[model samples]
Target: MKIVFALLWLLRLLPMWLIGALAWLLGSLAYALARERRRVGLINLRLCFPDMSLAERKLLIRRNFQHMIRLALEYGVCWWSSAERIRKLVTVKNLHYVTDLRAKGEDVILFYPHFVAFEMGAYRMNQDIPLVSVYSHQKNRELDAQIYKGRQRYDNCYIVSRQESLRSIIKAMRQDHAPFLYLPDQDFGPRDSLFVKFFDTDAATIPGLSRIAKLAKAHVVPVIARRVGNRFELEYYPPWENYPTDDVEADTRRMNAFLEERIREIPDQYFWLHKRFKTRPAGQPRFY
Candidate 1:
């Protein structure tokens, strides 16, 4: 593990083009060798995009793997690169959506989805504004510690564990008016999850976005991170109006609808490797 981390750190010394080339080579190999993950990615693509032919989905999967590898290798940049380098690497678009709200002493919840460039973009965002995000501990203690350190490397950021109570996360957000970097996608079983329509499939999703916005009295500002050519772009959309309405189910469905629209725009960048529809409603057979 130490050797692997050292190699990733060494990767930071290489040029972006060289790194991308390396990612292409390695990602292609990974796509060919990592059978289970490739299968899962294909299954996910099929579920979400039934109309697309198998060949098109496979091409998308390959591209997704390439992008995933590029982003993973860039973790070293996020952890060790200078603030100036990161600023140049990642461009923040319309950041005032979160900044203006924070300036007014209003808490904001960044409705971040499971984009491949999420961590790298978050690292860049943390350079300017304090962010409070959830942390799920890994089984390996050393790796978990490293991840925790990398996330909070910027001052004034808070990394709360998933094991911690919701009150703790709320308190962290309240402190310094940091925006909660919430990821509302992914399947976490059925508990506290509503089967929402994700890309025309009933995906088990947690309505935490609306619930958290209501609890923290925060504005739900959608943020997306995309890798364009050699650099990353963090696009912040305007906050949703009249969000977290009395209907929780409707709010959750709306969240999924927004995500589906964005995924359609950049199909390969979305995290299709995840088992998004792993948890089905009762009597439905399991996917994956």
Candidate 2:
């Protein structure tokens, strides 16, 4: 993994367009080589977009694979490139949502989904403001150190591990007024997770958005990063009104629904290569 990432770091010296083409090529090769993962992506697409024909689903998966590769390759830039270089490659949309909330002395929760250009988005946001981010620990120590240093290199940005107590994260948001860059869409099992419908499939999703917001008195705003022909765009949404309404399950479902809508806009950008429906409800057939 370290060797591969090192190669990506070297690849970062290439022009952005060339980097994108290289990523697409690598992803195409990965799609051909990683059979089981490709199967998982296909299964996910089938379940999510049952209305589409097989040919359409196949096309989407191929494009999705290319985007996924681009994401992996772009991590080199995300980790090592100068902020000014990233500024040149990326642009923001609806940034006033953040400025307005911060000006009002409100803590912000960046409700982001897992998109292919996610690293680019996170790095860009970190530049705009100091971030309080949640991250899961990687198993590889050397690779993890690289990732950790890259993410926390900026000043005063706090990163709390998901394995720790949620109180630490809640406390930071509640008292420190740091913008929590949170991504709660992925499956984390049944523990503290509610079964929510993601594209009509019951996915075990963490309900941290409402839980944290209610505790911190923070405003939740949606953000996403997408690639447009080798360039990146980060979009910020207005805070959800009347959120964390006594219904946690409903709020979780609402998040999934919002992600579903967003995913459709950039179908190939959202994650589909993993077994999204892996941890199924009781009596449900195995999805992968």
Candidate 3:
């Protein structure tokens, strides 16, 4: 771990494009050698894009590994770089959704998913707006401390444990009037989850998008973060209209469908390394 941090510190001194190129090189190696991740990414691509040709899938698999590697390497920048430096690297589009809403004293629920550039965008947002989100403790002690502190470096972020009740998250957001950075697309077993169609496949998804919004009385604004060439782009979409309509299942399905559209825009940036369909219905075969 000491050596890893030292290498990251060294890498942080280099130009971002150079770091990006190095990441691509490393990712190419991983694509060739890391059988399980590559296989999982390919499987995800196949499932999500059944209409694409085999050759197209192969190309996407390679590029997705490259994007995944870039995500890994950029963590150093998010951790160690100054706010001014990061500002130059990250550019936002449609940020008025955040500024405008905050001006009106409205609590916003940032509908963020597990995009590759998520950390960068979150780090940026944390600088100006107080962000409250749920986090699971990292397994590594030193790395955990660094991550926790790094995320709160701006003194404008609050993170609760995943095990905590939603009431606590709601209370914190209401008090701070902070934007809740919610990521509800990923699976968390069957508890508090419902099977929703992601790319037309039944995926175990959190039903909190609508519930949390209703509980917090917040506006739902979808945010998309992506790596375009050397820098990152964070786009804040318009707020959802008439959300949390007393139909959790219908709301979750709509959220998943929106994710499908964004993923289609940049298939590689969407998280594909994980076993997305890991939890199946009682008798269904395991995805892994």
What is the C-alpha local distance difference test score of each model?
0.90, 0.86, 0.86
| Regions of candidate 3 where Cα sits further than 4 Å from its true position | none
Each candidate's clash count: 0, 0, 0
- For candidate 1, write residues 1-288 as lDDT tens digits: 798789889999898888999999999999999999999999998888899999999999999999899988988888888889999999999999989999999999999998988988898888889999898999998888899888878776898989898889999999999999999799999999999888888989999998888888889999999988888899999999999899999999999999988999899999888888888999999878
Off by over 4 Å in 1: none
Write one digit per residue (lDDT tens) for candidate 3, span 26-70.
989989999998888878888888898888887888888888888
> Candidates 1 and 2: which is better by lDDT?
1
lDDT of 2 by residue, 1-288 (tens): 778888978988889999878877887888788888888988999899999888888788888888888887878888888889998888999988987888788888999888988888888888887788877778998888888898986765788887777788877665447788898888777788889899888999999999988988889999989988879999998889989889999999888988988998999888898777888888988888
Superposition-based RMSD of candidate 2 using all C-alpha atoms, in angstroms? 1.4
Q: In TM-score terms, which candidate is top?
A: 1
Candidate 3: clashing pairs of residues: none
Q: Which wins on TM-score, candidate 1 or candidate 3?
A: 1
Rank candidates, lDDT, best first: 1, 3, 2
The most accurate candidate by lDDT is: 1
lDDT of candidate model 2 versus the reference:
0.86
